[model samples]
Structures are given as structure tokens and as C-alpha cells.
Target: MGILKHYSGGLTREQFLFYEIRLVASLICENNSRDEIYNRIMQENLFQYPTERMIRSMTNICFKRIDSLASQMLMEHLANASTAVAKQINLYAIMRENGIVYDFMTDVIGEKMRTQQMDFSHKDINSFFDTLQEYYPAAADWSESTRAKLRQVLTRFLVECEYLDNVRSQALKPVFLFPELEEGIRQLSDETALCAFNCFC
Candidate 1:
């Protein structure tokens, strides 16, 4: 991944896409339940232990944002997932599509927010790129176009309106990018998932 990956927009699409990967991994792991999931995550080849809390925060925060943004029909559909296992899958899939994150998830930005203050060079971006790249199976072969789509969706959520005030602890968020080519990203970038999404936001 190139340093500060750039897209058609100024948002942190790459950062949020990284978080979404964590979301999917967590869900897949969750399908197996906490102990099993934790073990899979603990495997040195798989999930890293240090950022596990951030994954949980992402999940926790995502649901809240979804609840706030989704409509009664969408909410009802989520309710229909019924089982924890099923709900987990539905949520995982939705985040995959919508690129929306909970306001509190921005807290992860705090740890690396000052990365700019340092006289960082292009090399520094690799550390975060490595963290993001490792979370997914190395064998997975996603093309550049597909990856751009993933980042594009994430950029929508990282925009201004999606942020949380956090009156209790005031802090701005961190954003990052990697420059690449894309065609008609706008054709794909929109907040509305359904008529309800149009009605709600």
C-alpha cells in the first residue's frame, strides 16, 4: 500500500476499510463464539491480540450507528436475524456494503493521530498498511478495482456528518489514504442503501 493513499475524496477510506476487515474477522470469529474466536485470533498467523479491543469497539460502535441511521423496516430486518449467530452475519455483511461505522470507533484514531506530528516519511505508512494487510488472509486475491470499491464505501462513513461529539471526551479523528486509480467511484458512493436509508438520512 502506498503512503497516504489518495482517492477522489479527502476522507479516510483506507482506514475505515481496515476497520471493516476487522469487523468481518470478528464476526466470523464470533460465529464460533468468544473462546473459539479468541483462539483463532490469538493464532500468530491470524488475529493479533493487541487490537482485539478495537475490533470489539468497532462492532459495538457500528451497531449503535446503524440503529441511529437505519429505518424501522431495516431495524425490523435486523431484528429478524433473531439468533446472535445470524445477527452477527447480517451485521458483518451490512458493514461490508455500507462502510458506515459507529461514532465511538473514531477512538482508534487517537492512538495514531499524532503520526503526522512526527517527521514521518513514506516508510511509516507501511506499518499501518501491514497492520491492515495482515488481518486478511494473504492468499485472498482482491484486484485493485475491488479494493478501490472497498475504500470508496469506507470514505462515505468517515465524512463530517458521521462523526460523534463525545461530549465526555472531545477528540478529532485520524484519516489516511493510498493513491490509486478508480473509474466512476461516484456511481457507487452514496449513503442510501434502500428507500428507508433515503428516508432516514
Candidate 2:
């Protein structure tokens, strides 16, 4: 995944969609192709989103994120692991799929963890975007509303992964990667990205 020239806004619609992702992962483990999975979801209304358009949009994001791993072991873990482990695994998958998110986790959140800076605030997010716009000029074109929504989505993602105590507190929490999940991640041969979880190489 090269540096993404344009940040995807899909997360704003659904952040760390654990249940939806688990459903998709389960289907993937069953040897379903992308089209088959999408069709199955469409037929079953598995996501229970109440609108076909919403379901399609979410499935697109989930597939993009899951396919990025390309690891059957990880997909199995995502489908069967305990909720906490599954969330972490999904977060890792998101980082793999989305360069903007990966950069934020590593450069902002991970760096904060390394430096023992427990307090995270909107200011930090703004600063990160400022730096991001410098390198990825397309990011500079995002509307304030879009930027705000992205910030909300990113914050919720960290909270869901237990990296933050809550949105209000914005306090960093210690995240322990399950051994099984860690092994699954290592299998991808991208141990460097483990730093995003505060696991220094």
C-alpha cells in the first residue's frame, strides 16, 4: 500500500464495524469469493442496515480492509477470536488497508505511546492533518466538515480498539496484542507496522 494520495471517507460512515466485519470474515473463511460474499450479504441482509445502499457501501469498505491482509489465518481469527482480540485484529487490518489511518496510528498515536504522552486531544489530530496536508496535498482540499468527520471516525476507531479510554477522556490505554493475533500479523512479514500497536521492533 503506497502512500495514499487521497484519503478515503468511507470510515466516516462506519467506524470499526466489528459485527459487520466478523460476518464478512466468516463468509471469506468459507471459501467465498468477493462477489459471492457481496451477493450473500445482499441476499441475507446480514448487516441489517435497513437500506441496500448502506449495506453495499459498508460491504465495500469491509472487503477492502479484509482483502488487504490476504491472510486466511487472520481472517479465521477475525471470525472466531474473542471480541477484544478480534477488534485488535480488525484494527490491524484497517491499518494495512488505509495509509492515512496507518500513518495516524504510527506517527501520532504510536509516537505518543513511545514518549509516554497519555493525553490525546483534538489539537493533536489537527496537527497531524496539518502535517499530512504538507505531504499529501489532496488532504488539504478536504472540507472542514469532512475533516471533522474523519477525526471523529479515527477517534472512535482507537476507542473501539481499546487504545483510548473513551472519546471524552481521550486518554491512552495500554493495548496488549493477543499472541495468536500477533503471530498472525507476523505472518504478513510486516512486523514494522506493529509499532502502531505500541509494539516496538
Candidate 3:
């Protein structure tokens, strides 16, 4: 079952918006310590996020993502890249590394792709969640409303990352890795490379 007993991310769609990607990229480019970067984001009055907690969450997530990729050189490559898509892909990788839900979500996508199931549907998402609940009893307690929202937000994230054609539409779109991105991935440890490849693929 792909269900999480105690899902850890709990991030809203708003927290994963395009601007946040830009914000993360900027932070990575600055290459400051986590506390220094957090202070810079908070004091510079740049993002205008909802609360201090959300800002902290974003900062933590970004740092965790950088760590998961397991290479400061790759982080530098990503920070220097020209396309927003590269940064989004990196963020998506981080999300996969840091969030149980994201790992399951992408695994489902990869499975469907391998099976040549090109079009995804809401029913598939429901089934995936249903399967999760079977293994994670706690998942059974999640409200239908909450499940629906998560499904919507996850789909939106895929669309933003060019993994899907659109929300509510399961058309899988492959993102071609930039040359620098590819090089960086190759430089990572075998385990980290495999994990990053799963997200990139």
C-alpha cells in the first residue's frame, strides 16, 4: 500500500508555488548558512509569506532538498541554470526525497508510464489512496475533502513541473534534463543518483 501512516510534509499548494522555486533558487545561489539564509529571507522582506512558520518550513524544505541531492556542486549548477523548469525539477526532487506522499505519487506515475498508461485519472488517484489506507490504517481516517484537496494540489504540482499536461488530465510529459543537471546527477553518490533519476525520469 502506498498510503502513509503519518504523512510528514503536510504542505499546502500555496507553499509549493512557482515563486517559492525562485525563492529557493535565489537562496541556493546565495550559498549562505541555513540560519543566515533564513534571516536574509525574513529580514529582506522579499517573499511576504503568510507567517514565520511557513517561512521556516520553506527554508527547511529547501535546505533538506539541497542535502538530499547530496552535492553542493549540483546545487550550484541548479542555481546557475537559466530555466525555471530546472529549478522546479530540483525542487520536485527534494519534495520526493523529503515527503512520503511525493515518493508514492511519482512511483505511481512511473508505474503508469512503464505500463504505457499515458492518461491519468482521478479514479486512479482514489485507488492509490485506497491502497494506501489498506496498509496504513491511519490513512483511513483522512477526510474525503482533505484527500480531494491533496489530489488536486499534487496534480497541480506535476503540471507545474511539466510531468503532466494539465490538472485532472493524466497525460504524462517527460522533462529533458539539462546538460548541467545531468552532469550534476552523475556526480552524486550511486544511491543519491538513483533517487534523483527516479524523480527526473
Candidate 2, residues 121-168, lDDT tens digits: the string is 999999998999877787888899988999998999988988877887
lDDT winner:
2
- Residue-by-residue lDDT tens digits, candidate 1, 1-201: 111211122223223333333343444434555455444544542434368675455544444433432243333333343333223323323433332221112213323343323222223323333444444343135455554554444333333222223322233333321011011111223222211111111
Task: Give Cα distance to truth, residue 142, candidate 2, Å.
Answer: 1.4
User: Worst lDDT window (10 residues) for model 1?
Assistant: 177-186
TM-score of 1: 0.25
lDDT of each: 0.33, 0.83, 0.60
Give the per-residue lDDT digits (tens) of candidate 3, residues 45-138.
5668778887887777666566666666666655666655465546545554544445554557656645656677787777877877765666
TM-score of each: 0.25, 0.91, 0.74
Query: Which of candidates 2 and 3 reaches a greater lDDT?
Result: 2
Task: Kindly report which residue stretches of model 3 are placed more than 4 angstroms away from their true locations once superposed.
Answer: 1-9, 179-201
Error at 49, model 2, angstroms: 1.5
Ranking by lDDT: 2, 3, 1
